[model samples]
Target: MPVTRANAMSKENKKVAVIGAGIIGMAVASCLQRDGHDIFVVDPNEPGLGASFGNAGVFGTSSVAPMSMPGAIRQVPKWLSDPYGPLAVRWSYLPFIAGWLARYIAAGRPDRVERQARALRDMLGRAVDNLAPLVEAAEATAVFHRNGSLFIYRSAEGFAKDRQTWDLRARNGVQWEELDAAALRQFEPSLSSNCTYGILVRTNGHTSNPHALVTCLAQNLIKRGATIHRTAAIGFVLDGDRLRAIRTTQGEIPVDAAVVAAGAFSRPLSRQLGDRLPLETERGYHIMISDPEVRPKVPIADQEAKFVATPMDTGLRLAGTVELAGLNAPPNWERSRILLHQARGLFPALRDNYPEDRLSLWMGHRPSLPDSLPVIDRSKRSPDVFYAFGHGHVGMASSGMTGMVLADLIAGRRPTIDITPFRANRFA
Candidate 1:
């Protein structure tokens, strides 16, 4: 179901508290403001500087495949053995995440994968179109780019191995042009000669600076009379089936309705509302090269390495990797460093040596569910309180549609898309 701006059932304005100032939170606040709601955004840190700050910046409209795909279980042992592989699990945290791992493997069943892909397509198919107005309203249009993205493979056999995944995308209405070695070079000459095959997804795009784009959206909300609370939401004060206020580190703030969009920290809040959902952090890492000798015209993803090299306003960002280490673990800078080695293989012209000052490394938590779908339904304890977190890797690309759907739910209107798959108690 494509997203559209449907009118609310009632025009009565409500004071809404949106917890978390990340991309998803800001987008929800913006959409609620458009519906004439008094918006209060709550977060201790500066907006968009969380996981939203360090994403690959891809619009990823064609990314309907779940992280746990068919035949994914067979490769987990290999990925875990390799320290520098795309996937790694901290041995100490295995006990904490074993239940999650079981569910993740279960989601890879062929039947489940098909259903998840359809639901993801419905939620993500028109992300850019849904976000265009918000980007324009924020006056941050310059940060947005629609140059499209390329997924390059190192060998013909490598491309052949991924036929099922590509077929899945095609079945879900994702369009792409297959490029052979010669055509791939003609399309993006900066790529390494070893890149023998490619899939050009024309519908995909990326942001030049994701942090700036989200900050601008937050600023726009402020200018339009929304309040920004520089405090963390600790709990909720509920009266029967309705929420009276949100308890925060600073103090309690009264609100007619509330949305929990606190990214990786949303599980505890949902637990307080009596829904103990299964959520974990997929710690992601990235490296930014300030001045690279070669820059791709569009974002290029190495199919084999599972990382994306995207041209950003600040620099060329090489972002990807999944570390199943819980929050509070020390930063593994080695994960970030591995991306630099992978980037050199994709872009041969890039300088082999760069000054220490020219490199920027970061690690952030991607709030993920085992099944790869977010929980977007109302809390079991209260209808005035809604849940919207666990977007995993697609949070940046799907934030706009998720916000619009939440606004519709809060305003007593049916969402344009069927949200049955995103129920909060599905795991139960």
Candidate 2:
């Protein structure tokens, strides 16, 4: 937004071009437009319908923990061998993935893990508070549901393992309540007897339809005079220390400022601009059972398989797993089957949830950083270039806060939160 700068006479007219129409990009565009900047959003898809479309949609502030934790690095070998393991790296992709794994392994150190948690807390802690007003303005209150998320444990030992993470969440001021099996059954009457202790993160929420949320925001952006360009953000036209325009197949969209939020696709684009970001894609899969009539209102996080059962508008989505395969790979049905099997285990009634033909498959590569803290800092090398990608599994969770920070950066105001932790050069 063009705010009255300290140099009052020099009205800095800004034309902000956002790359990628994922929730992050859309949110940034929406925030900038709302703040009075001329806005344009460019992406291959119209808006949403990619990672933003099929995401689990959990608005989890409790996710201050990174994807690579203390013991996660050692599990890579086991995960690679086990088809149904929670994580995997394909052998064909090993050479490339190995580099990513090296970064991930270093991030698992105690000091790095602590920094990752703090940075994640900083990124996500104020996310909902900042973004909720924007959703309210869009007039799609129904899309954002505040029913909270429950983490159900399969055993008492599992519950103990859960405490380690929950303790971290609590330290960061995330509100939660420990619920025993009896308390869990009250809300999740459908849960099987095999599940016991649970942690109810009341601060959490989810989107019933993420596509609808992004669409509503996009529509609102258009109404507010922001242009939505249906084109892929292939690269950028580099000026000295800045990206003067975003390069797309349609043409170069000339601009004063560009925000690269192209998700996993951002690495190459950033690299071309001389910021070789440590961005990798965690390829994930989901199985959706369309419109299950009888469903629990709140979402469930299964501790056993590390998956999430989220009831959506069109269907109930079982989503999770972190596979470090390249983009454009075929959907792994084994992972999808593993999701259904986990769903059935958690909710015995789901065995007859839907017709086999009614099930749908989806695969998306969520852009991940070594620390799992998304990059939201300005490119140290380029003043006109900013980054908002690498949210990993928490894209939806952190999008709102990301947008707010982006708007602040663009408006040339001191951002409300410190940006040092999310700097793109942190890895370098």
Candidate 3:
């Protein structure tokens, strides 16, 4: 039998430590536990309160387009000049991030962008299917629905300008339906008449509550005999090429194998493991209304405005934006306010006089790599240490598949996809 196949049937289970309790970590812990491995998760903050909490709630499997495209570099100057634009990088922090910015722009090369898109599509194409079993096992199916997603454009010209993106999506085998103004309005009556063109991805879907799903997954892992330590992972203890234990604020916990899915904080840990990844944070903002007057049957994205409005169980969530200010800088709440204004423009029926108590404003860091792909490979320094972070905007959509692939790597099995693109040594 193959080494991985032998391990699968060994009957000797190993203790695996997952160093994060967000959606990614919880998902990985759940997968490893199901495979009969002893699982332990460690994190300083409460699980599900990070980026996993404030996401747009859309599981965009068909969203395989990379943010870095042929013309993206030229748009950066204008985007940075406009404070309220969809993408912005602080001028003061430019000098500090100059190196990463250069690489980010370089990834926009035509050939590179296409390669990134294909890799992302391969990993996220089966997002809903990959997550279904886990969602059902956790009894959280109510949160996720395959109602598909809608992208509305302000005009035919605007939609025409995005033909390149649509073409790329088509090349990746993404299914969709184009709707005229009348059909679009009938499909999502909540959308204002200003949105004249609509394209609905028939295979896409979203969650009504992202935080609830994360909580459900975490709870399910705990119920399945997995231990969760509410402590910060400070470092790791390695014995030669193998990891002996993970050092945390509470204490050192021994482990036979480990996964670092700490989101934006995975950079320092990666550096400690001898691979200096160019991991940066895209601080994303969201505004949630507790009781909305109007609700969309499915999630809708204003293609021109660069924001999404997803009808959640509690209310409608308006979320999007890419702000680069590193990890320690304070959030600019104005960005969240801007999202509210843009959302109102898209949906005119939203009452301006809604109670202030019904609103929730949030900002969280999204771990990202320049190439717009995550590191789902093993650490170059430690044989037993694996990496699974830098997912950018697709973290939620890709979490299930990421967990499955990482589990296979941990079990010494060849993953179903080519993970070479996500290797830690890529940056090196």
The numbered model that scores best in TM-score is: 1
Q: Lowest summed lDDT over 10 consecutive residues: which window, candidate 1?
A: 1-10
Report the C-alpha lDDT of model 2 over 255-337, residue by residue, as the tens digit: 77889988888887788767888788898888898766347687889877788999888888989987777886676777877
- Scored against the true structure, residue 387 in model 1 reaches a CA lDDT of 90
List TM-scores for all candidates, in order. 0.97, 0.94, 0.96
For all candidates in order, the CA lDDT equals 0.91, 0.81, 0.86
Query: In candidate 1, what are the lDDT values of residues 1-428, reduced to their tens digit?
Result: 11111333243688889999999999999999999998888999999989999999999899999999989888888877887689988899999999999999999999999999998998889988888899999998999987789999998899889888888888999999989999999999898999999989988889989999999999999999888878999999999888888999887888888999999999989999999999999999999999778778899999899999999998999999999889999989999999988888999887776898999999999999999999999999999999989999999999999999999998899999999999998899
Better of 1 and 3 by TM-score: 1
User: Model 2 misses residue 327 by how many Å?
Assistant: 1.2
- In terms of lDDT, model 1 sits at 0.91
Collision pairs in model 1: none
Off by over 4 Å in 1: 1-11
> What TM-score does candidate 1 reach?
0.97
Ranking by TM-score: 1, 3, 2
lDDT string, candidate 3, 1-428, tens digits: 01021233343477888988878988888888888898878888888888899999888888899978888677777866776689877778878788888888899998988899889998889998898888999999999899899999988899998888888888998989999999999998888888889999878889999999999998898898777778888888998998878888777887788899999999888889889999999999998888787899988998887989999998889999998899999998889888888888888988665666998889999998998999998888888899999999999899989989988888888999888788888887
How far does residue 182 in candidate 2 sit from its true spot (Å)? Answer: 1.0
